[model samples]
Target: MQGALRFGARLVAILVLLAVLYSAAALSFALSPVSGRPQQADGEPLVYVCTSLAHADIVMPSRDPLIDWSTHFPAVTPPGLPAGAYLAFGWGDLRFFREVPTWADVRPSIALSALAGVNDTALRVIAINPPANDPDCRALRVDRAGRQALIDYIRATLADETQSRPVEQAHLEAYYLARGRYSPLRTCNQWVADALAAAGLPHALFAPFSFSITWPLEKPPLLPGKS
Candidate 1:
């Protein structure tokens, strides 16, 4: 009986040691931070990793259709305005379209939609995009020449600005409405590629689906490529 008791105790001790080692390793991994670009699944590049809140904030702006509502909706006058008058008068004074649209605009809606459907307790929405290797393909890298052109356009549009506030309000309303919806994380690769094409930059928007593993325990073959 004493021998059996000793054996049981030894087994317990071994189990305890294993548990401790496993716990230590797990803690180390959890505490460590990942660096550099996320690995591509098929061909898509991962650009940003952030919480749903952060993602939401970035995407709301891009989905906004920069339209001059006063010009577009000349027939529909603002409420409480006279027949000959307009709503949001003098709105064109402020500069609009200072920055180009990006994927950040639609991230919030995406997060909200995903959270609504899935169990967000253990899972996270991972967004992937194409690599921003070329200067013309990056919003941040809107070159001096491009910046000048954009500014010139804005100045020209706003120069004879008659209905500034109404147009601005329309944009603001659109932004708020989009914010209320599920704005998915935009693949900046596509946005940049589009911008490049519009600007006559030599680059193509490649829409390839891919996956990545943010955790170390995740084995290889992280994500399958989808073209």
Candidate 2:
């Protein structure tokens, strides 16, 4: 019994150590000089970087009628968004996004697979009018080229065939399309960071969490009613 107890204690210690190390590495990357660039303040053609409690998304205007979002992701606007909708793009674990509508739907296997890097990647898209600036979301401006590059990156993430597309979700009124694979190291948050970097924006070298991805957008994060 004592031997078993010792073994359990050792396991706990190892887990705690791993968690600490992970946190330290993430923070180091977050505070690095590379991620310190402030969001571009140039007006118009602004793009929003939104985040929820556990996820991050890029919100951009639907300026080009040629690339109509409704035609591609019709689920976003069933009755047709006449005024057009601001497109929000997010990436996550394929199975988790399909099965887990909210955090409440999380399962042990889902969590473990995402953390173990054994999961496939999927994209989540939503089209809303005027875009949302809720407590969880913050807007950032991007140049025309930057926005186009970001869109290109998203398109590249999607497989070249329709067979890769997953079934649309009825809950969030969003579509889940198969894209890159996911792992502990290549999490959705990391993808967001990479997207920002690919677009010539400043972002953490390894943003593993939503907050880390959102933090660099504003220095000394603005508290409620303070800004």
Candidate 3:
């Protein structure tokens, strides 16, 4: 029984060490600023960065009907989204797309595989019509150059280099294969933070969790007519 006890202790120590290293790396990459603050130019677009407890996504400015997201993405965007709906984008492990059809399908092994970056990646898109004053969302205004750079970075995340456009798959509605190496170190939270930094918006140097990314947006409410 002493042998069993020693093995268990060793396992715990290894796990603890991994946790510390992951935390350190996540903070190091996530927090570093991309560049100086962006200057707002004429006709700069305004976008929103939103997050949930486990994931982070971008709510694109989709109020304009002329710009059909389908043309750009060509994927299964669920029908019946409101005319003024915003397109939300999220990136995650490829195994997560194939295996975890629902949260119930998640297992410890699968989660670990994903966190270790052994799996591929996918991008999920959805349409949303959030309330005008969403406390959970933060607006980021980006100049033309910054906005273009962010868009290019987003498009480059597609997994298929040959496919100039997105390859729509039937089984997973509103999701497409994405390019990028995702691990515990490069998590969804970090992706959102990186995207914001690319857009030249004010952002944290590092964000490992949804709260870490959204904390800057969630300030105490202001009184009516108060600055």
Candidate 4:
């Protein structure tokens, strides 16, 4: 009986060894770069550049609605523009509020913002291509020229003294607008893309599925839907 017990113990040890080997193999396969593609997260269908005004406080609605439009109108309207123009121009505030914080956090908002101010939908359509799962997908970075232009535009817009009771107030207004429009989902790489586009630099958006990955992965395929 002792001998039989020893044999049973040996059998159990072998099974355990085999199981360990199998588990190790499975783990290696899963982690291997060539094994499968990385899974794609749900993301926007396209990439876009955000407008400068979208980030300003003047454009964004205040927490207190009563104090917003009526109280802020004198401060919000640009000099030399009619009240109707302010209303129309202020629509950008909504887009800013809705924007996601970063490209990884919400790609569609980035795409839409990037496409803003462009009248051609076809061009906008071309700017939305970037793989959701690609580590390099967030690499879009803004260029120096674009950055300077944005800064200059902000400076000019805020320079009008009549727009505010004080020059500082105008500055604060611009600051709030920019802050509100700032996208968290936007990556440095994406900013480069946006900045370039903002400066009239040319680029194209590709289909996300076009990216080739060696690993066995799952990316949510794009489907037809309203933007």
Q: Scored by CA lDDT, what does every candidate get?
A: 0.27, 0.70, 0.66, 0.30
Candidate number achieving the greatest TM-score relative to the actual structure: 2
56-119 in candidate 4: lDDT tens per residue? 1111122122222323334444454333221211112223223444444556654556445321
lDDT of 1: 0.27
Off by over 4 Å in 1: 38-227
User: Mind giving the per-residue lDDT tens digits that candidate 2 earns over 102-199?
Assistant: 88899999888877757666787766666555677776666556666787787777765344344666533565655667865777888888888877
Query: How do all the candidates rank in terms of lDDT, highest first?
Result: 2, 3, 4, 1
TM-score of each: 0.20, 0.82, 0.74, 0.19
Model 3: residues with Cα > 4 Å off, grouped in runs: 20-36, 41-44, 63-68, 76-83, 98-105, 161-173, 216-227
Which candidate, 1 or 2, has the higher lDDT?
2
For each candidate in turn, give its C-alpha RMSD to the true structure in angstroms.
18.6, 5.0, 5.3, 20.5
Residue 102's lDDT in candidate 2? 82
The number of the candidate with the highest lDDT is 2
How would you encode candidate 3's per-residue C-alpha lDDT over 94-147 as one tens digit per residue? Answer: 677667777789899999898788877887766667534786677765666666
Scored by Cα lDDT, where does model 4 land? 0.30
181 Cα displacement, candidate 2 (Å)? 2.4
- Evaluated at residue 160, the lDDT of candidate 4 is 40
After TM-score superposition, what is the CA distance of residue 31 in candidate 4 from its true location, in Å?
Answer: 36
